[model samples]
Target: MTLADTLKGMIGLDPTAHADADMKAVLAALKELNPKPIEECSVAEAREQPTPADAVRKLMTQAGHAARLPLEVEAVQSEDTVIPGAAGSNPARIYRPAGDGPFPLILYFHGGGWVIADLDVYDATPRSIAAQSNAIVVSAHYRQAPEHKLPAAHEDAFAAWRWIVESAASLGGDPSRIAVMGESAGANLAINVAIHARDSGLRAPLHQALIYPVASNNIVSISYEENRSAKPLNKKMMLWFVQNVINDEGDLKSPLIDVVSADLSNLPPTVVVTAGIDPLRSDGEKLAEKLRDAGVAVEHRNYQGATHEFFGMAPVVQAARDAQTFVSLAQRQAFGGVPLEEAP
Candidate 1:
């Protein structure tokens, strides 16, 4: 079978399967594809079976193997930089493209609901975007929810963008060519950051790329109801994340919590991607309509036969790569030409 077919088979397993057996099969798949075996696997095997989260992480690691990512790209050097925010510190990795004077910049947030994923976890996707898009990538490591709470992640995200704008010249990125991009909850953060930027009268992002973002405050979208138990990301996990992020139900209606409810006028050009079987699909589609109605240039596409988190699982499927390519191209066009001192 093709790699995609194999991936479909593996991820298609019942989510309610025995955790141990499921993890074993997932580990075996990773072993087949050659993974950086974690020592915890042996430790966990000797103890009580892995949790569902553990199983999902293992599956995601295997999906990394299934991605069509160009494994060998000229490495863009990165350094950890701390950016000041409203709440506290937001750490970011500054990716400088090769031969760059001042490349266009992309501020990336990772998807892990609002809690789980981190900058290192989503490293490959950003690297691919940097290499293919030929732009500097600043991956934001925002504070997770439950620990940071609602508006904390959002505050840090906006602060990271502000810091990028303030320090762009020093970091070899065009301040005028700043774009915001994220996946899943990160995508949610990205859209909300644009909302903040627009409302605050600060210069908005030149472009925004949200890959199947969580855009609704309400959890009644068709995809949410249909794919509630889908693998990689599920309804319970999503609600859990959302609950942890927001303090009260009242916060849910706040424009900060739901960009779909916010005024989308005067926003930047947007490329919104939605997955066929993702619960968050309708939110993105709705957000796309709002942006267009507000006169923002928008290109929205839904990838059929894919699930949530497909954008970051580049190792498993071509759909992920294709989406990245599309987003990168859109960013390039939206930013026009990078007026850097050197070529990126």
Candidate 2:
């Protein structure tokens, strides 16, 4: 049996019947790439591991699809730039759909557990969001772990938020109508950005789209126990990420890291997304619960048969399309703009 099948079999989960067919294909492709486990690799080795996005691209290319999915997913204007960070400067990418007037801005973050992956690895989601949500999307990259551990990324997130807020207008976006977005660990950064803004009396994000966020330091929750062997993102991988980023056991309790234990009061309206076959599913669900309990407006959507990092694979996954629409509609309403029509 293949490594993917062997792993799934060992966990008593049937890949073919457990996840969506399309999602299964992507997972299989990723497994076929045969990267070392995050727990078993050096930081450099981990960074080089084939990602879910790569799997999506490979499938698209092999299927005789059009180009590498920036425009294939949705047509939007894109540019690369640099932004100031808590440490040295970091890189950023901006996505704008066809338009004349300034559009609503979304300061975004890509997920790699604060270690691997960069702006290029996460191009699909922001590009799609720009068109469907009628907003300009600015995706940011921060310092990574094993080199720049916890709070390094957090500080950079705040710096990126500060930069985006001031420069939105210059980029053909409305500074007054702004939001924040991210996937997985990046979502953790996004919410912390909002909390930082509220505490510092800075401009607030109208909404936050948190896709499969790393909400808590709790890695042994029910969902974690269940999807501990799920592909692309299992409990072991999540633990590896935490281990690399934190300096000590105490770091796990920091509000910035254990966001579920942080203050959720007065944060923006939130969209918490969860994948049925993900270790962080509990993270997303728990954060949503805490947000609502803290009196923030919450819209939580859990897609069964989907996996972590599926948010950006809409070009190959139907759940992704539905999620894109769900997030777009939510953001449109929050920005007080006209309703966003379905993506063409």
Candidate 3:
């Protein structure tokens, strides 16, 4: 038996007890890879850890499927551009669908706890979103932490949104129908951009889709307690990320960081997605409740048997596929138009 199997046998842990069948399979395959625990690794080592996509690609290769790193979707055209930011210029990639008059725009942010990962590591999501929703997708890359620190990524996100709004027409996107969407830390930025736009009297997003967002700094909620040891994201790993991003403890309470404390009034219609096995699940739930209480239209969905980082694993995880469908449907309804093609 593998070391992971031996460990499981010794601990009497059943994979199905916490995750769905497909997720169990993923976990098993991942365990066989014998990756080092993030908590015990240095920042560089943690950053080099294999992502779920990497593991899935390996599994597929082992199963006789062709290995395709950074899965691609057929967008009619894609271009990379640089957007000016407070610190420096940020790189952004825009994806346009085929035969588009002026498609609705989705300003997408990728998740990396505001530190690791980048547009290249998360190419599959925006590609899939652009193809599935037939919208112009601008995937933005922001400055990371321990070098740039907290609030830098947030500022870069708002700057990217502003740039998109100002240049939407040139990008073949309708400014009036623009939306903000992201996963994990990117989701935090998406909501913050909406709030910033509303407060700044700029053109607010028509909608915001946040997938497994980091909504609050309080990590003692029931979900956190239950999933503190969850793979991909755990409490210890989160603490490491927090330490790397924030300058000090005081930043934890900032409204931009602790979104539950932020004024949610008059924000755009919102959809918050949560994973059943993620520590941040309660964060999403609390943020949704706060948005609704502030009189904003809100839709919250918690996918059972899903774990953190599952949002971008649609190629392997059924729950992720379902979540992606939910996100695309929400975007379509918010954009107030039929998709260029029906969502699968």
Top candidate, metric TM-score: 2
Which of the two candidates, 2 or 3, achieves a greater lDDT against the reference? 2
RMSD of each: 8.1, 4.3, 5.4
Residue pairs clashing in model 1 are 64-315, 66-315, 66-316, 67-314, 67-315, 67-316, 101-341, 101-342, 102-340
**Residue-level error in angstroms, candidate 3, position 77:** 4.2
Span of 10 residues, lowest total lDDT, candidate 1: 37-46
What does the lDDT read for residue 172 in candidate 3? 78
lDDT of 1 at 105: 86
Off by over 4 Å in 2: 1-16, 64-74, 339-344
Candidate 3 Cα outliers beyond 4 Å, as residue runs: 1-16, 64-72, 75-77, 339-344
Instruction: Evaluate model 2: give its lDDT.
Output: 0.88
lDDT of each candidate versus the true structure = 0.72, 0.88, 0.83
Better of 1 and 3 by lDDT: 3
Every model's TM-score: 0.79, 0.92, 0.90
On residues 210-299, what C-alpha lDDT tens digit does candidate 1 reach at each position? 989888876766666666666455666677677777888898898776777888888888999997767788889999998899999899
Best by lDDT: 2
RMSD of 3: 5.4
Q: Which ten residues in a row have the lowest lDDT in candidate 2?
A: 64-73
Q: What is the lDDT of residue 344 in candidate 2?
A: 42
Please, what are the lDDT tens digits per residue for candidate 3 over residues 231-316? 86777788888899999999999998899998999998888999988889999999999999999999899997988888877777
